[model samples]
Target: MSAPDERETLATSLYAHVLALRAAAPDAPLPPGGLPLPRGARPPRDGAPGPRAREAWPAVTTLVRSALADADPVRAALALERELSAAGIRDRHVYAAVAALPPPEEARDRARALARALTRTGTTVTAVAAGLGLLVPLGEPEDVPYLRALGLLEGLGDRAARALAPLDRKAAAVAWLVRERSDALRPLVDALVRGDEQAARALLTGLSTTPRDLGRRQARYIAEAVGLTALLRDGPGLLVPAFGLLARMSEGPEAEIRAYDEALTLYETVADRARELPPLLGHRARLVTLVQELDSGDARLLPWPPGRRRAVLTALLTAVGEPENLSDPAASADWRRAEWVHRTARHLAAVTTAVEAGGRRAGAAGVPPTSRLRIEVAVGDLGEPTGVETRLLVDGRPLVPSVFGSGVGEPPETVLLNGALRAGPQPTEVRLAEAICTEGCCGALYVTVRRDGPHVVWDGWRRPGAPPGLPQAPAYRFDADAYDREVSRAERDLGWAWPARRTAWLIAEGLRERPGILARWGLRRGWISTDFHRPDVTVITFLGPPLRPDGTPDAEAATRQFLRHLPDDGRPPRERAAEALRRLAEEDPRRHPEPGE
Candidate 1:
């Protein structure tokens, strides 16, 4: 078999092994499935009892089932000791034994009662801890106090106790613990962050011994931390696993809000530095869904007024910019680049959808609108030699004011919401919003949909814009219309190859524009197209639209993963491409195998 095929086979096998290990010891910073590692390396177990734990499952399961049912506490204790001893387990690992046994299939109320009893006694046995954790997935409401009580039981000190005091919510407490316990938990987070898969097993096993929900929350937070860490990590291998956990945990409003904060942090961290990593793209894709969720009115922010939250949300979204769709000149300020046109256009679509829904609500209000109820973006985030300016007006009033800025301008969260969303509601106008604020910074996206149902929808209120505002940013500005026109022309001219041509432009235009030789070389190779089946390595990246309407990689998508390309070179594909380009820069064009450059 070819060397590439061998690498693919090895990676696939290693991935399977790592998955099994992750299942067995979830709290460890075990490697995700896609990490490319050297030969014969095993993921560290952090003193985990692999074979011993495996052997103890059946025996421990029987003991736990009996112990859970036995009226005699002494008999249950003895049964646990005898079975655990026979299976080569010890005191520290008693949690693993109880964890191995599934939560009872029925009698959920009884299970909760049993869990509460275990908590009251503050049992040091690992099984009790394991029992406490299983309650969450087994239909327990996951109380903050219970988690705090468990932490105290496990010798979790004053910090953990103090952190859990204010919040009754599970996710909020978890987020806090992620910050406070960075010393103890940072290892697993770091391991996943580096894709090292080292002695994370012990950390993971420690979590697993009786802590499913917190363990899962740790995993989710680890993914978030890793994604933020990816901004400087040189590659995006950690992103897929991180975003996957985020997507899974984001089932409700509180969870979604926490996740949105994480996503925004991730984007703000890496928006300018590393744009093409798969995980970064994945994170962006997730942001679209998250914003959509906030706009959908599933979670009502009862405390905030209508236009207030939506205005903030719109600012954040527009200022943050989309992953695949940034205009040529600018990104956001926190991202160190600002974009307005396409960004505002995106918000326009979201608000228009909400407006249509609001119009339905208007029908209930006995006031029907004559308009077709679609939004029109009269002016986009336009960039020019003179200055940067853009707008999103609703029914002749501003959804957001003209956005144009450069270098470091005003606070971005304020810019997108400057003097907008204040118009009187049309017969069909309905706006829904959720405001998020922290450390004196606040923002949110607003959708104009009818308050059709008695849900927590609000009307766009007349409010003055907040300031400490940003001026026009021209250095990072591009004439978005011109850029789009060029892309459209390429589509008209080349059809399927437009993606390739567009990629070539990115490689040539964007990369070369960087102040480095590596960029120029890589772009040349992209235009040359002499190495489609390049051996050893080829960097796989994507450009243009990410998903089809059906939510698959669009026709233009050609990522290494989507294209069935193999990983042969030990280095990352991006690194490999850079090396290849460096080599090509030295080679003579006359010696080329085949070339169009």
Candidate 2:
């Protein structure tokens, strides 16, 4: 046979011996199957065991089983001991099985005798006997210390606690004594914060039973020491009580408010806080939500107390008005200005109901509407050439005389009006109004007109070099007519089926090119697209109408000139020729002429 085949045969023989030994010791369970026997089980291939020794395995199994079945474990153990001594069964397979039997009362005497014999014989049988001796329960903590020192905790598990209960109880008592002696139990505190959940829970439960002030302080220290502030911010649920403890520890109104604000900054779920807090403090929850809305440019202001409302509005206007605040010129242009104004107006509208309620309350004592009314106007933009005009109209006629100015290296004009006769504040009895604008010419205008008390004010503002001529009437009247004409031309240029769709498409497209346009219209991007369909394609559809009333393009008609090539295939010709165009416009009236044409 080849050398490889010889090795395989020897390994097989060793495995069979291990199995035979396992069968002999019926009381002891075998090790997990499929393990190869140790080196001692096989001799050198050149000096293989004789056939007679191989055949002796079955008789060995029978003898070992008979010896273990003896009534006294001492007798059984001694019998196996004698077999080990006489037969020289050194394989772990034989020794492990003998070790597994429960030790008899005289097991110690028998084990010592075997140990001495094995020692004299210079073999490992004594080591195996000692290991079996240790397995007998001695009920001593000293033995456990050896296990513990070796970090064999995994092997002991709950067994260690039961076996050394007195030692464990003593350890707990000592820990408590340490905590009592030192005010700063740094080790305990560190363990609580970084220990396993069970250990931390046990420590925290003990700590909580301490005096209230000390407990609260300790909890706060642990919370801070663990770097839990950011974690609390992300998940306030875990630290809700911790925040309450912090509040309890804080002193004075400012300190309390600072703590509350810090905690509030960590969580957006203020509704729960609102529900939990007293009514007066519940308002702060709403305020937080309102402030978030404002910061995000929601254009939905809260109708709070005048003082609060004024504070918020003032802050917003100041932010927009500051030269440094206007970050980009393109963002501060006319389009952005219109958006900012519109958003401000909507926000103002949301708060109008509350303002009106407050006004009624002020008028409770029969105060007449004739009280002096004041209107304040503030304009903000880049430091470029910009101007404003104020016009006050009363009873449908001009009230404040129209005034405009330009900046030619001079400061932009700021005007304050009183009851003086610059076209006397049109009497309040007839209906007062106001309009403001950019420049004196008032040819190009951004105007705001409002009726304040019994007088009227009309105002407009423009960039420095706006058109010079001011029409005799309000600019909007003329602009309205011009606007209509442009709309008509745009509709005709783009073959729109209805003016509304055309308008919607135009607005949607304009907003897409300039997102700020939606803010000016007091609409959201979602609302714009929701109200219109295929806005881009619709723009193309309207740019050139394809349908004729009779469902045929009037090729010979002058009025329908723009409809000649309404549906162009969106491709270059070389790749697909005119085939794509022909296919796309097969049913299109503009592409298909009358049958006889």
Candidate 3:
């Protein structure tokens, strides 16, 4: 049968099912199978519409109301369908129009019928989105399957989530979507545990068995759902999963983890629970992670008072046991070589003597026992065939691994000279080297740079999200004055400049001197920068939107203008750059080459 005929049959069947169920038991929850979908071919993809469309299309409400005013039910439905089709998911007012139908039972019933029909048999994602929005206040439990099935479609998860929000069984509906798209996990768990006592317990209980690897962001949501206050109150009642949650919490961004109120109490609770529970291998692995985080001195355990810190450390060490004594041999071996285990053995004194005067051990001369010694970035060939690379040199030895190099799309000047050593008032992390594939795919070496009195401290050493067993750099302290001089000297010494480097340098200098030039092209000066993508050419890059949307020239236009005017030759960089900038300033993009032209 034709698509329209199939949709008509499904709509008719759905109406019959709802009426029969209502007649049989007026107050009973509707069956899951009440609304059957049309079996027609799937609709074409239009990306999910965002709230921007609602902001842009201010006339959406009037159009929707006009559609709904047709007196004949068939024509009203047809008119409403046209509005949804025209506006699609873009016009959110379409949904608001149906929801706001004047509340005579007849008009509301008509709105409900229209929503059900669109949800059941609509061909396009927009129709589905419109249906979902309309149903936000009016959807019955029976509409869930339609929501779930269409929500499983690529672009409909958020729309489905909103529609499900008003239903009694929202948790089940939301959970069904989350299983298919883990991105929606936060809202699901948040909705479940928000202020409801029984629901919080159920959420925690359900999360207890969930797979440990939900990626960092999702795991944090789970922790936030089972918040510190909730955990402190209810944590003792639970066992293993609480430990799992704590372990995940330890791996989160340190600032957020530290913000967990009554942290000392929470740590003590976890330490006590570790001793009480049977030490399964999973628990052991999690324990090792917690212990590792505690020992790292990267701000996790630093905030606690010496007495409290000592007590927690003592409890954890006693509970975790020596790696050699572990029952599982493979697990034992893994823990034996682990960084924290080694650090604990060496600094067992600092932890134990926390309450004692001068108990902190001594380090190499001029360095605190707790702080890693200072290091410096030294430029060297180190085997890359193209541009120069950088490595962290500690005591004249290459400390960072050779595998990390200046990856494509970033220039060495940006990576090393300016970016790495810049210290802010707050502790800041700078990626010293990225994986050959780039920072996103494989991890990068990030050192936290902060000022400590007369010296600048680079202490929190991490290879975040990197695979296990890459070399971890120790923290370093350097004289702030000397560090500044070295960076300045490095900046002035331009012996490393090749053709690509020279071009990038010129563009950077030109932009830095006259920041207003980018504004004429509708670009933010802060967003603009330069990269040496190849040895032969320099590419201008943007950290954010390259151009404003008001019919102005974009990054590509800037790049083309610069490339056409600037050429590699014996001419000085400053001279050539000035010439290029002068020419660029003379042109008017608005009149010559308009937006989208």
Alpha carbon lDDT at 555, candidate 3: 46
- TM-score pick, better of 1 and 3: 3
Backbone clashes in model 3: 0
Which of the two, 2 or 3, has more lDDT?
A: 3
Off by over 4 Å in 1: 1-55, 89-125, 137-147, 152-180, 183-336, 340-597
- Predicted structure with the largest TM-score when compared to the true one: 3
TM of each candidate vs. truth? 0.32, 0.17, 0.40
Taking the tens digit of each residue's C-alpha lDDT, what string does model 2 give over 1-597? 788865555433222433444456533422222123333333233544332434434444454455435555445544554554455433333433433444457555444444232222212232223232333333244443322211111112122222233343322222222222244343444343233434433443343212233442333344443333454445434333433334332311111222222333322333224234333221222232233233221111222343543455333333222122224535633333343343434333333333445544322221111122212121211111121222222222222222221111111111222222122323222112222232343323233333344333434333333445534334222232322332232223221122323333344344456644323322234321111222112221212233457665444544322221212133332223224223323434234443333
* lDDT-best of 1 and 2: 1
Q: Which candidate's lDDT is highest?
A: 3
**Ranking of all predicted structures according to TM-score, beginning with the best and ending with the worst:** 3, 1, 2
Q: Which has the better TM-score: candidate 2, or candidate 3?
A: 3
**Worst lDDT window (10 residues) for model 3?**
376-385
lDDT score at residue 7, model 3, on the 0-100 scale: 68
Per-residue lDDT of model 3, residues 1-597, tens digit only: 988876665444222433444456653422222223334223322775544544534455555455446555455555655555554434244445434444345566665666676667555444555566668777888887666545433345456656765663333343333433443244334344233545555555556422333443344444543454456556465566666666655541222344344456667888866688675544544564465345432224346765665567667766765445434435553432233343333334343343244424332221122212223222111111232444344432334432222222134566554555666678887766666565677666776889988888777876655676555556677777766544444455454454445665676767777777756655443322223223333444422233346645464643332222233454666666666567556653233332333
Rate residue 568 of model 1 by lDDT: 40
